[model samples]
Target: MTLSLNDLPLRDDLRGLTPYGAPQAPLPIALNVNENTHPIPDAVASDILDDIALAIRDVNRYPDREFTTLRESFAEYLGHGLTPEQIWAGNGSNEVLQHILQAFGGPGRTAFGFAPTYSMYPLIAQGTGARWIPGTRQPDYTITPEEAAEQVRTADPDVIILCTPNNPTGTPLGLDVVEAVYEAARGIVIVDEAYQEFAPHDAPSALTLLEGRPRLAVSRTMSKAFAFAGARVGYLAADPTFIDALRLVRLPYHLSTLTQAAAVAALRNSDVMLGMVEEIVEQRDRITATLEALGYTPHESWSNFVLFGGIADPRATWQQLFDRGVLVRDVGIPGHLRVSAGTEAETTAFLDALASIGSAS
Candidate 1:
């Protein structure tokens, strides 16, 4: 007989949990996840291969527990007068976030996030035995400083997550709003800058505000802009004190030798690896313009993805795109769907599919 969840013991809090990710359905033109999907330029690819080969030679030995060199690479790349002491790495940003929760949140603690944001913030907090508090955002998905500060005051959570260029919505959070929340909350404030590289030229990163705020931390990842999702490397910049706290919770040698080597190679070739960003930005704007012309309401995006509304039925629209071999995300919002900016050709293909189909159902 097959044993099911009912037959085995599980954590009471996790008894009814479904997995977090959306379906990774394969299709001709996949614009679902907010990934770069652009291949690394040839020279960068060659260097990365060499680094991988070098890392495997030392694979028989345990990896570096502190990932010292990797931390140094991150510091150099970030270039805000940051040092290795303030850098931290993990398998991905998710794991880095888990470290934050494990160090500062648990049991009696609680974490809060403004919703229609990244789904994982609450899930990660709850996984650490901390309660998750959901907050609200305006209809356009922007959270004003007043609303944010009010929520922070009311919940008084231990960890406050601010996801700029928020996932699935693609709307950015303002630095002033971040400051307001930080001032109102008594706990640590984490700014998830996973989409920072894609923001418009005038938009500022919360990293600029790190000077005097010891309690503020900013999270980033290689997966989106670097086209290194398969590498599974993510990192953050923050106070040395914050880094010290995360160290207590992270497993020794958490980042493998291969991951460190690959990430370092990518960082060293940052210019070439990031060369596609401008082109992708163009593609994102093209998508927005096309969507508007096609009568959909596309949110002004500072990220690599566009979130648009005005669909008659999101589920059917998702299916319509899927049927056409162009996949986009049905992010559970009413009358809205999200799609990532792909290569120029891929973007055209997605646009053509949508334009021909019109509103689905």
Candidate 2:
């Protein structure tokens, strides 16, 4: 017999929940999800292929649960004097976050973040049965250290999520705010810097603050910059003790042999792998500048995506782009929409489409 979710004895809180994702319909120009628009450089692809072949030779054996080599390579990439013992790896940054909340947040525990930030932060808390509390950001999509501290003091969350160059908005928070949040809360503080590679050169990473702050964890991914999203590698830099705690929560051999090999190859050829970042940054700047010139309010973006306000109807705008063979994100923020920075040609197409829409409006 057919049944509704309520008939399946699902958790009451999860009964009405829709899964989290942006629309991904494989449009001609897919700027909806914040993904790398560039294909892997030929040389790098060749190196990765050879490494994958080597890794698959031993596929019959269980992969390394420790992910030791990947962790060491990541530690070197992070370069805040991090040691392999202090690093942890998971399928994606999302899984790394789940491990964190599982370790520190639970039924009675709470996790907090600033609003107009990463939507997944709250959803991750819900998945772990932890209460999610969102504090407000400024009108410009930034939160002050004072405001963040007060929110932490009030909520007393067991985990704090700081999304640097935060998703959707792309606002980079200063380390001051991170420090304040860490000091005001009693639990683990996670600074999600998934897009840090796209930020301005001067943008500081929370990894720099890891020396004395054992409770502070900085999570990053090879997806955006390294163009390794398919590799499924995300990691964190924290104290070795905290890394040990994640050992209890993560599944055994979570990082596959092929995944490990791919990540290692990417890290080994870091220069070639990250070569598109500067070019992508150029496209992002072009998008921001063109949006500003068109009389829309493009919030300052340090990530590879731009979120622009002044959209009278974001759903209509999204549909308009979709109709034109492009797909951008309608991030539920009224009067605004987000578009990822793709190839220069993709950027021009987006601009030309928006210019048309504006003209007709």
Q: Each prediction's TM-score against the native?
A: 0.98, 0.98
Per-residue lDDT tens digits of candidate 1, residues 201-275?
788888898989999999999999999988899899999999999988888888999999999999999988888
The alpha-carbon lDDT assigned to residue 30 of candidate 2 equals 91
After superposing candidate 2, which stretches have Cα over 4 Å from the reference? 359-361
Cα lDDT tens digits, model 2, 1-361, are 9987878988876878989977769788999889998999998889989999999999999998888899899989888788899999898899999999999997889998889788888889999999999888889988889999998999888999999988989998999999999899898999999999999888888888998888999999888898777777899999999998998888888899999999999899998878899999999999988988888889998999999998877888888888998899988898898999999999999999998887322
Give residue 154's lDDT in candidate 1 (0 to 100).
90
What are the lDDT figures for the candidates, one per model?
0.91, 0.90
CA error at residue 5 for candidate 2, angstroms: 1.3
TM-score of candidate 2 against the unseen true structure: 0.98
Model 2 misses residue 216 by how many Å?
0.5
What is the alpha-carbon RMSD of candidate 2 to the true structure?
1.1
